[model samples]
Target chain A: MAPFAGYDMPISYPTGAVEEHNICRRGVGLFDIDHMGQLIVSGPDADAFVSHTVSGAVLDMKDGDARYSLLLDDKGLVLDDLFVYRLPGRWWIVVNASNLETDVEWFTLRAREWKGTVKVEDVSEATYMIAVQGPRALELLDLMGTPKASSCPRFTSGEIVIQGTKNLFGRTGYTGEDGGELFFPAQDALGLWEGFIKAGETHGIEVKAIGLAARDSLRFEAGMPLHGHEISPSINALEAGFKWACDFSKPDFVGKKALEAIAAAGVSRKLVGIEITGGVPREGYDVVSPSGEKIGTCVAGMFCPTTKKYAANAFVEPQFARPGTEVAVMAHGKPKSGVVVKRPLYLPAYRR
Target chain B: MKIDSAARYQASHEFARKDGTVFVIGISDHAQEALGDIVFVELPEVGKTFAKGQSFGVVESVKAASDLYMPISGTVTAVNDALGGDPALVNRDCYGLGWIAKVEATKAGEFEGLLDAAAYEKEAGKD
Candidate 1:
């Protein structure tokens, strides 16, 4: 276990990361991601308040709809990435654990700016998040879960009544799998954990608890962005190639002015996937040209079990972001030959 | 937590056991267990020489890369070539088939200076 965002979390179970990763890819796997934070946004003028905070256009989302959006600072750089959910009475946002307090305070300040009509509550302390991912995730969940889990539309929040307790879940995950991120009370953490395990057993599937190590590798291979890795305070959404997250048509949002100006001027750097051989590439490693001239920096790399290649995500000059472009990654003080490729190296079941 | 009683261990976790004129070198079972799944192993070429406690090669797991230290001054005699294709052997049989390399010891006295099974076991527990 290691300390992350003030929480001591498991890097992997005794079964190891490689096995845990493979299990999530093929069968069913569970991740105790309670370290993530949740918040409820509501009250009069909430639409205007949320619209002013996030880069995404959240007003049009129907109830139960969820959107992956960016929380940007006025300077047009990402402050955090969040999942904004449209509940019946309020907007439920899931933010990164490391930025929980800052995000809550940001919302509180923004609400105050609106004359205190908007309400922002920090519900993270009472929440628990479990990611159930793989091809058979919903099936495994439906065995004992209520409210017909599969009926939960993909990419949206759905309700599940567990022993009369209401839980919110979304058919979404960082790993490239057909699964849901289950959100419920922290007090029911044990019951939900054991329920999933028992359900997995009933289906003849081993529901292993995945750790942070495999969680990172799976996200890296799926072309998903991490807080400190891909999208940080210094890295803007456009530079990270998350243009879709930024809705330029939205009127009056934080960072909208700067982001629109950048879009008009075009992004300087681009993010791309690289398959490296001879060594493993890691965060902050230089991406160099054939002559060893520094071209970019690697964000993360790992052994991609699906592709059977050592894959990495790097931000490089736009000229080298094309697929099949030859590159090299400086790994362990040595340059390892690499080539740029399209991301999401392992295709997700939902996409297929 | 299993230890091969016949081998002597370096504090860095490499184990060396004298075999005729050569000494078989591999990481301890404790080290392999801590490393989780081993994905790649880089070993020194045969005939390369190193001083005691010097880094000879690298062993990579899914998590990170770690340097393998020489327990005693020796010249590389042979490297386990099968690791090139399947490095998980290190996780499965670290002391037997997973032996990293065979070395012709140049400073034989260094082996005796290393920790015995009982002492190494006690040290491993502390970690």
Candidate 2:
């Protein structure tokens, strides 16, 4: 186990990261993601507060829906990426574990500026999250007779009962596969995890506990942005290729004016997918052009278990971000040739 | 977990076995286990000469990359070509099918300075 976000987290299971990654891609894998922060926002001004703070169209979301959104600073730089789930009377915001305290403080301060009633509560300690991901994930859940697990569509959330425990089930995951995330009382975490494993066995699906290593590789293959690696305080949503999450059509929002100015000026750098030909490219490696001019830096790089190739997500000049554009990555002090491909190196099989 | 009794070990977790005049070299099982999933390997080319303790290649796992050092002064005779396509051979059988290279020993007497299986087990436990 390794220290991550104040929690002793497993980096991989006994079978290792490769096997765990294969399990999630081919079969089913379980992830204990309890370290993620959960915040509850409700009141008369809840919808207004959410719309004002995030870069998503929160006011248009119906109940039992979830939207991927980002919190940005005044300078239009990202503070963190989050998922805002609209329940019956409240909005549940899930943020990165490392940004829990800062996000809570940001939300609390913003809520005080509301003219109507608005209350923000940090419920991270009382909540636990588990993700079951793979093509067979829903089949295993169906065998378990989990209510709403099979019916929930992508980016949707609903209440469900698992092993007699009430929980919030969301059809969302980091891996580019069909899966659902379960959020329930912290006390029922172990029971639900064990029960799901046992239920998977009945359906011939070998559900194995996955660790942070596989989780990272799976998400990286899907081209999902991680907080510290892809999007950070210095990186904006436009450059990170998250313009879809930003609802510029809204009248006004936090960082709206600055983001509009940035959009008008055109983004300087763009995040592009790179396939390494020679060696693995790692973070902080310089991306160079054909003429040996430095272009950008690699933020995340790894050997993709699915593609069986060394791929990376890098920020490079807009001219060098097009697909099939030849670029060189400095690996082991040598310029290894590669090409900038489409944004997502791999596509999610179950995306609707 | 299986250590060859005939192989001599280095404190850095490399193992070398005398096979005629050429010595078979590879990482220990413990080293492979510590590296998690072996993904890529950068092997030294044949005929590349290196002194004792010199870095000859690199082994990368899903977690990080580590340098592989020469156990003794020798010239590379051959590298395991199978690992170029299937690096997991090191994790499955670190001592046998996963052998990294065969080297023609320049100083045969250097074998005497290497730790035996028993001494290696004792030293590895201290880690």
Candidate 3:
């Protein structure tokens, strides 16, 4: 089935969504993320230019290290969430597939207006992203390539030779598990995917060829905010609980001033997790207090596989931000009980 | 998968089995397959009246939520309470134990509009 990201993505395997979630939680699941955009920001001024365009401190990052950041307009609304990596001479910016065309256009327009030099090129077609997520992901990936579990830290990546194949590897995952995501050529994807599946068989790894359906749920459980829902141009990063990504200490970056103003003014709204006691909380569900008072709105909600109950994340008035705060969700014309909880519905088992 | 001809179906993916006044209602095999895993089921309350083609409840899979539309106008007499604790039963045995609700048909000719197993297979695009 097609998904909101504008891809006719698979909902799950013929075995179904339950099996796919279970497979990834207990074993490992492979996902085809070829549709995501990969851009190379090179040239002599790549480092300085990237720092100016994004929200995070780029100069502090070392080669091969990856940091989660957001590209924002001058007004402080997020254009998109992206992963930035410091390569040898240039930088690599990986953006959401659905926003590829828009992101390229936006970045190119800014690059042209810049007083300094920065070469931004779209390299999406040349790269293919495959994510191996779940508890057994690292082990399964190691079988296909070299094992670097002990050395590689979380949110970091490196160039590794796997199964005689040279590929870019990162110790990151959307699922709340210890795993890695690899980037290689589209031609190499099918082979490496099947190879991992075969190698994972002996280790009791259930190979789930996951699609976008499970991808959304996995990211939600990991407390990772999405672009359109949680971090749109109308939404502020601080309100989306991404204040950590904004660095004022850096020389300066887009939206830094606006973020500082919001932070100082005290956030009017903030993102918080909610567990639905009465029903499945879905995206766009209205948030209300127990007495029929409107508080905020849910951006993402799902029936959590791990918890076996309904869970959601919402951007609510900051007064209701405390954990255990009682709330209500309006669904099917009925008000259901909900409560504010921790940020991530589940904790990620990053390879520390 | 192949569709079973003996199983009667509806365009909305609902399946029905009639015996005099009582008809067992649930989604078709094609639906269960298309929906992937059946995680949560919100069956209509017993003794609730619904018009034909009206939404009675919802079926939540791991990925998306599907509304369960009434195949025929009727009053809900009973629900499959077992689904409350084991919703996956819908995925495992959708036509049998996974049945949604038992209804007392409001109109006699409503059942005639539903498709037989053969017609349903074609409508579901399984053929």
Best by DockQ: 2
Ranking by lDDT: 2, 1, 3
Clash pairs, candidate 1, are: none
* Ordered list by DockQ, greatest first: 2, 1, 3
Q: Looking at candidate 3, what is the lDDT of residue A202?
A: 67
lDDT of 2: 0.90
Question: What is the C-alpha lDDT profile of model 3 across B10-126, one tens digit per residue?
Answer: 788987778566888899878887777777788888999999889999997765789999988899999999998888898888878898999998884887878987778778894
lDDT of each: 0.89, 0.90, 0.81
| Candidate topping lDDT | 2
Give the per-residue Cα lDDT of candidate 1 at B120.
98
Candidate 1, A228: how far from true, in Å?
0.4
lDDT of 3 at A210: 79
| Model with the higher lDDT, candidate 2 or 3 | 2
Model 1, range B12-37, lDDT digits (tens) per residue?
89999988999999999999998888
For model 1, the interface Cα RMSD in angstroms equals 1.2
lDDT of 1 by residue, A116-233 (tens): 7899999999999999998888888777678877898888888887655578989889899888998998999998888888878877986888999989888877888999888999
lDDT of 3 by residue, A148-242 (tens): 64367788888777667677887776778777778887777777877887787767667778776677777777778877788898898888888
For residues B84-126, write the lDDT of model 2, one tens digit per residue: 8999999999989999999999998898899999999988888
Instruction: Give the distance in Å from residue B110's predicted Cα in candidate 1 to where it truly belongs.
Output: 3.2
For candidate 1, what's the TM-score of chain A, rounded to 2 decimals? 0.97
Clashing residue pairs, candidate 2? none
**In what order do the candidates fall by TM-score, top score first?**
2, 1, 3
